[model samples]
Target: MELHSHRMTALVLLMAAVALAGCRPEAEVAGGALDATDGDPPATRTALDPAAASAPITLEDVMEFDPRYLIGISYPPGMERYPGLAAELRRYAEAARAELMAAVEDLGPSSEDRMRAPYDLALSFDLLMETPEIVAVQAGGSLYTGGAHGIPLVARFVWLPQRDEMLTAASLFQGREGWHEVSAFVRESLHTSLSQRLEADALAPADRFRLLASGGEMIDEGTAPEAGNFAQFEPVPGVDGRLRALRFVFPPYQVGPYSDGVQTVEVPSAVLLPHLSPEYRGLFAAG
Candidate 1:
């Protein structure tokens, strides 16, 4: 069976930025990685500055296996300047593409027949928040391979450009002790949000405590703040360009039913600052 082809349509701010800014496509390589002949783009080192207003890093769509399976990936421009980070992104994208393809193949002999029906598997990434210290990107999409409904997933990636590696909750907060504090804050925030929903009749009182308890249980099982329960996060930048609040993301079914959709809770700077390491605290301190 052959997959259908369609002209790519840019989605959301990241894609739109690439389109509007006239980001020229780099020479395509056989594999998913793009070559960086040009020196690292300035955007890689600094936050997106309105004064300069350079185009945001654009991703190229690689591993397109018909309409049934496709993977669109791109990293911070000039990522190639940092060989380690560039290699990591390539590995991640390729592994993700392979995993999705394997799932399609698992559909068996009926796979082709199933493809004839409406089916889609798409994965895309977007730059969520960027600062001199941390760059956060979100990878999310829906997969429908013959189910009652498509499965929606969202994962976050935090990059420390200076360190030339990815950031985890432990590393960011300096130790497990800080992570424990973060987890507690998340639980409190979740309970408060649920309570508000119940009061507003957005959620039935009968389901309120059960759902809240499930969310808390999931949080407790994770060793660190971002282990399993709170895998996605973005730092809200303050007016002064410092970290303001940390946003925790939960996909559908993590906190509530599929109909409830994705859930997010923001922990303000005041709440998170005291728990942060001196290193990270400096990143958010007012100038």
Candidate 2:
């Protein structure tokens, strides 16, 4: 599940209100009013090349509202070759910018104490996998809004090149039953990982107790293999470059305190083959 930025949520609600009033905001390009700068320019290419494994997907900065907030957006250069997918990526970046701006507005005019330090907002995307069949991107970062700490988020976008469609967590499974099995596997993996962490001698007894208490909530089905909970995942590849396991990602505070940082666990494809739909089962099968 993706965490909607405050601004994105507000914008959606505002749009809905406008719709009820029979009006709408004029559409704008991806960058909107932000002053764009090539923060980390990617490699220049003459054409779309999905198979270009070494190609760079760089990030660009939108600093029009800097000192108040900052946003970084990017789209892989060759994405335009796939018009629909390119549009989706552009829209995603634009939405991220809207969220950052909305966050700044929600803070209102900064006061002297608030002005002591500038608010921070950042969004960036990374291409995690680029197999011929699928391409996966991870988009997320931290946002601070005059709080005790900033909230970090991570989301995954998997595109099926052959189908020219995006894959949701549910779509990757066989059916409702398949999802349930995957969810159970995720919960068990989390429990095992967390137990190992707690048993480590590095942590103080009090810290371990606190973690255990706070992390207990994560053990149930509610926090298990639902679409939202497992939004960020990737296929783990073996030495032969074949898919071996499915790795699920969990950002901090998702399953434990921030101090615990991000957590990840992988379930072997072999173990999940029975629960996978025919379409993906073959892809995950041993090479």
Candidate 3:
């Protein structure tokens, strides 16, 4: 216990040394390790002003006293209304916490020279688009544990109020051929984007193909026509209260090297309308 306490002191110093703006812990909000079985918003979250309270719903928790790690998890303001959605988000956050704890346990005695924080987790779920038909959220965040960089995590959720069902990429489409078509469209967009970056127009045909192939392989593999490959998406709503397009999100290392960071491709509704399940076709609009 004596050694453990000393190590915790080190964690504080390490966090202070590397903490970024707005990364400070919330003294009021306790750790979210336990479940809120009653399905109510975490009571510890601060109350918003009356004007803001009536708007979006938010649930956030940050902890810094763990001695071994630090964590932050927040949900969009409107999420509080959907107990089911809130529960799913909680489970996701808990899973991340478990992973961080396990990593901490496996860690050997801390050396005095290690400066980076041992383990840190930050997850923020943002409301992507909400229409009367469906509400979408983009879940993006990172988890770090003694590495040159933190691992990126992301997912998307679509909630149907009328059916009380959560829709995923797998559940949103029909036949396998549809996935193949969608895959092709995404690949074309990504390929063109890569070509522009490599300045293919300036290179000789041979050099263009060679240079494009170097980076395009990862893009192709990452965007295979499987539903899972395109699971993380954000809906782009048209001003007419309809869908304009859907942006597919790819975290680092999925479509390219970590240095490329996160990559996204917007597949216009025209391309996606044909592939969408019949029930969801009305949610989108072309042009």
Query: Highest lDDT, which number?
Result: 3
- What shift in Å separates residue 65 of candidate 1 from its native position after superposition? 4.7
User: What TM-score fits each model?
Assistant: 0.65, 0.68, 0.74
- Model 3 C-alpha lDDT per residue in residues 117-170, reported as the tens digit of each score: 456665665566665677776655566665444556566667766655666687
- For candidate 1, the C-alpha RMSD (Å) to the true structure equals 10.2
User: Model 2: what TM-score?
Assistant: 0.68
How far residue 183's Cα lies from its native spot in candidate 3, in Å, is 1.0
lDDT digits (tens) for residues 23-106 of candidate 1: 645322111111111111111121223322222333445433364543444444444443443444444555555655666676
Residue 158 miss distance in model 1 (angstroms):
2.0
Model 2 agreement with the true structure over 87-173: per-residue lDDT tens digits: 445555665556555666766454853453345545544456777777766655555454454545355566777766666676777
Clashes of each: 0, 1, 4
Residue pairs with backbone atoms closer than 3 Å in model 2 (clashes)? 1-228
Candidate 3 TM-score versus the reference? 0.74
Residue 257 miss distance in model 3 (angstroms):
1.6
Report every candidate's CA lDDT.
0.52, 0.55, 0.63
Q: Could you say which candidate leads in TM-score?
A: 3
Residue 114 displacement in candidate 3 (angstroms): 6.0
Error of 2 at 138 (Å): 1.4
RMSD of 2: 12.9
List the lowest-lDDT window of 10 residues for candidate 3. Answer: 34-43
The regions of model 1 sitting more than 4 angstroms off are: 1-59, 63-83, 111-119, 202-228
